[model samples]
Target chain A: MDIGYAFLMCSMLGILASIAFSIAYLMGSDTRKIVKKANFAISTFTLLSFFTLLYYFLVRDFSVRYVFLYSDTHLPLVYTISAVWAGREGSLLLWLLYISIFIVLSTRRLDKLDKVTAFANIIMCTVAAFFNFLLLTSSNPFVRLGFHPPEGYGLNPLLRTPEMAIHPPAIFLGYAGMTVPFAFAIAATYYREEWVKRARNYLLVAWAFLGFGILLGAWWAYKTLGWGGYWGWDPVENSSLLPWLTASALLHGVIVEERKRGMKLLNYALAVVTFDLVILATFITRSGIISSVHAFARNKEAYAYMVLIVLSLLLGLVVYIKRKDFFEYDHSYRLRERLIQGSVLIFALSTVTVLVGTLTPLLMHASVTRGFYRHIEIPLGTALVVLLGVCVIAYRESMLRKSVLHSLVAGTLAGIVCFVLTKLSLASLGVGIFVFSLVGVIQGYSSRKIDLRRAGAIAAHLGLILLFIGVMGSWMYESSYTNINMGVGQSVHAGDYTLKLNGFREVNGNAKFDVVAYVSVYRDGKLVGVMHPKLIIYNLMRSDRIVASVDIISLPLEDIYIAMGGVTPQGVASFEFYVVPLVSFVWIGSLLIIAGGILAALQRREEKARKGVVDAEGEG
Target chain B: MKKLSILVGVVVIVFGIALAMSFKSELCPYVTVSYVVSKGEVRNVQVNGTIVPNSTKILPNNTLMFNLSDGKTEMRVIYHGILSHYQEGIPAVVVGSYYDGVFHAKEVLLKCPSKYKVAEENYSTSKVLSKG
Candidate 1:
């Protein structure tokens, strides 16, 4: 059956089995055999389905529509593997497979909490059914006719870049992976009060993964697209960023709630919204609902199918809320919960603002000034303001405790020294701001409060500070030379660096093309690095794309870089060089953010162990 | 807390002033072709030119050295991209600053000459490669 039916039938059977198992759970099923059997059945079915699809793509099954559209005989094996999720239908199948695998792995060690475990199964299976519906009715993987062709339309050459080749599935793994947590949240809402607590630890893990995944996507855009800028305000990018921003907020808010029994509703809502937004993001990206050149779900059938799926889920949510005691009085807080309430407000506002802005194109014709509610320049501006507020509250909040408030104060001064060494203007203020946040992270870590779970939170905040400083340095007051001509051994000055065009050579890569212009960069009359800016004409596209290869002479202080040369047919190549001050700090900051997530993951795990919670209540 | 509030105020004021000034001047780079099309800021542009042997830059080089048609209207351009044989000519829009001894180009968008458009049908990739 070419593995297509195997995957389809297995996923279908698994979904049906899960629905039956859910009914059995509610009805007091005998020995839990039905659910257990279904879990094994569904997981195995999903795994097999994935492999079959992979085989089709690998072997260049031109008969299969997806393979024909995305894969060719000349396509490398890795790209073929990535092609498993190159389009809407295939990606959903990939999502279903990944979540099913996640379900198996999560449930392996979990022994008790019968209701939560069942809830997890219920959520996954139901979501699987939605994907299956789309697969079968609208964008079916196995949809085909009789004629067999020898060749197929190859994957877009733009996507053939080494970074983009890996981007789709990795990001999908992140986006769809959120479903597990979302399902868990739904289950937690019904079964136990401790469910929220138990779910918090796993939430950090998911958040951490999602954050890194998003950053990887951004880095890929910077390197491959040759846009010379990372993080274009694209809807797809914003869709991913919105969840990350909220996840960051929740990662920190979880700590406060765990300790003080505050922000419970905020925590719950954040969980739901974060997961739902993952769905919303899916609708935006996959349904061809957003303005991007890359879209697979353009037909009415796919659109209607997606709308039906979304509407049904919404209806389920409304009915679920009405039926259950969603908010309990037991976890209630005092009226003086300004910080908690403010935090929630900030998170909701920021997440929604970004969300609305991300969908600005289809939703309405927004003015250029109000680009989108959740754009990087505006939405991130608001988020940064909120983060600054969080830092203040955290430092003051830490003072309430007796043990290490003094160390935080001392560390603040030490941080000032570090910030000054970078030679930034407004040095003292930057120093104070970074140091205060650094102290919060220090205090958060030192008093046995820091673990891997909370580590992500701490690191994220630290990364934010670094990002702010690095961006301000790189983007602000940056100088460059627009047009200049020189030949081999010729030199021209560009922002703190003199670039000497060493020579030109042909660079033959996997994607066959010609790359010329090999240049050397010198800052302050000293050789910094080599820059090979190539104007490549792709073999397949018969089109051109410039590749700027920047060698970062990285330091805490500055970095030297060069990008794709501007070369005409007459042998005149133009190169741009830069001695960017303190760009490495951006990467340093990202590391800190990931580190904070790790901390949060560890601590939240212990807390989960204590409270007996699960990960992501509404993942399904 | 009060000091933090004051800090916020200061930042807002600074941003407001900087923004006001930016609107009066060019804080961001315009598109390369736009600058070329606009002919903004004409000057004697110094550039590093790599010889493509017989590319866009080479055609001009050929015209200039052999005096194919005109004299003294030649310009030196520094460009970043691969070089392919194009002495036969193609439709292209070149934008740059024209000044003493050079038209230093910021951006060049080129299209290969279509064979179907030409008469006598002496067109193929092989012919071009053999010439190169």
Candidate 2:
């Protein structure tokens, strides 16, 4: 424990040394190897201490209470080693170490960019040090209680799965990667206008991981959480989503500035705000702060740590802007009048609303401010159609170039399809819009060749519209519940189908008690399929939850999603009997959305490459 | 410009309709334990209380202990976390519609009166917490 504290203290001191060197260098001092060497020293000691902690767990060192309390004698070796990141404080320290290592790498002398990057690393390290300071004070995992612990409490059962590794790490990578865009933007802000190019790579890196991270989290929830749906609009989920949506807009917004020589200041502001929201998201998730399943939900220490980081960055950003004069080109009426322009403004406003919505809980907690303000993500819809709307203008002469009268006639036809599909449930508001989009697509396709990038963007938007309709259908219409103590071959009517629970079988694993209930789905006295919903009692949490593993009978029109999450007395498995209409559209739409992201990224890369070749007098 | 109006009109009209629909039946996850306790009715009934075994359970599972409290009366409770309650010492307001004899916890929300918040409110809540 003493060694652990000492090692952590050493790293904190290293951060100080780095900061000292940074201050000196900024004050125009030469020969700053002292701070660089100090950083390396700090990271090394921190790494060593971290390894010592890991090594102790692996060897089953009964003396260390963390090991005794968390690790079992029969635990697998992989879990034992990964056990380092399994606790509240341990994970904080691990992430801190990761940030430090990232700082060290980014700060190194890379031919020409190192000099400019030093400032960015200093900011990154400052953020990292706040975390280290928390570890050194409040929540040290290495604190000993003197008495020997017999066996370590295992990892939380929900967190012990293979998906756990991928989900949390991907989120961390995505969240942490946002700092890169932040760093380069700050650094470039202090330089000549030519340095804007330096920030593009950071933007791309942040965008890619943010996409992957959000996708991984969604996938994890779909597979493991036993929830019949994806994207529950949870506050923490919204926190991540806010930055992603804003950054997606900025990604396109920045390209306009990069290529068409417009929206430069807008791009810079978006970069800063996106990074700030990352801290806010961290605050929302870590601060026991809000009522979110994604968050740890009881840690005030996390909140304090995040607030300090946000304040420091805000101060640093101000210091940077005050130090340099960034050239701003006017957003002329021609550029400002465009649909994308209004779209970007609405996008930013929507981002602000999300930030406000997320922060509302923190405000309400103290009884400081209150009123009914929620549903931040909904405002993004304002600009959603705007993007697709521009595609018409951008590709007007393409294959779809029919007169306005054609859409009026075609839209009426498309509305009928939507109305019929929804079974007359009054949520037919999607009818008019879907019809218009359909006509737009068809007309554009029929008249001229659609630009792949432009066409893909429209298709993706059209798909999103489909997704919205699907989500509404599932959320409002779906109904399900649990079943307790039933006789052999007991039947229950759920929504539209009769389910006969045939039998229960007990299955044991290395760590969980599973009661699998086999149910036969029948309609009109015809046996259609058997769905097995498992009730798993995990050893780690020593609790029972239902994992309704239904043999999903998927159809083109409707999907029968049987979900189980808990066990009942008398060998009954608790399950949600649901038949969601157009459930498959959700996944299919998401894939199409991802395909759009890929195509968009490829489009940008090709554009950049061509620009690069052109700059070299078309030498490639 | 024609396309732009159509898109704007579509988004505004659709979202306007959604908001309008939502007002009739507010579907939200506000049915959390704490929210229920704050606004729901209090009734006397038996509940499965997994009174948390605090510092003692930090040891072994067999040496586990729990405290059963209804704010007025306290008792010893010992059952596995089958329908586990959150940590004890928390002034948890359990919310449920009681019938027969059981005060089944339809939801359990724990909100300990914040000593820190009180202090912060006396001075800092307006500045920091007000616009949080």
Scoring only the second chain, what is candidate 1's TM-score?
0.33
Q: Write model 1 residue lDDT over A1-620, tens digit each, in one string.
A: 54667567776887788678766776676535666666677778877777777877777878888778776676777777777777887878877776776666555543552777676777767777777766666777765546777876766554665666666666666666666656676676566444455565456666666767676766766554443445655667777777776766666566556666555556666666677677667666666555422233345554654564476457447635763555544544432244444444455555655555555445442211122331334334434533453443344454534423543465457656755675554544444555555555455455655455445555666677777666555555345453456766778877667778877666566655555566777768888777666554444422222233434356557755555544443445544445555566766776677666667667744766656544444343
Total clashing pairs for each candidate: 77, 23
DockQ (0 to 1) for model 2:
0.04
lDDT of 2 by residue, A547-615 (tens): 233446777857776665344333333456567676667666655665555565466567778898898
Q: Is the docking of candidate 2 incorrect, acceptable, medium or high quality?
A: incorrect
Error of 2 at A115 (Å): 5.2
Model 1's C-alpha root-mean-square deviation from the true structure amounts to 9.4
The numbered model that scores best in lDDT is 2
What TM-score does candidate 2 get on C-alpha atoms? Answer: 0.73
Predicted model 1 interface RMSD: 12.4
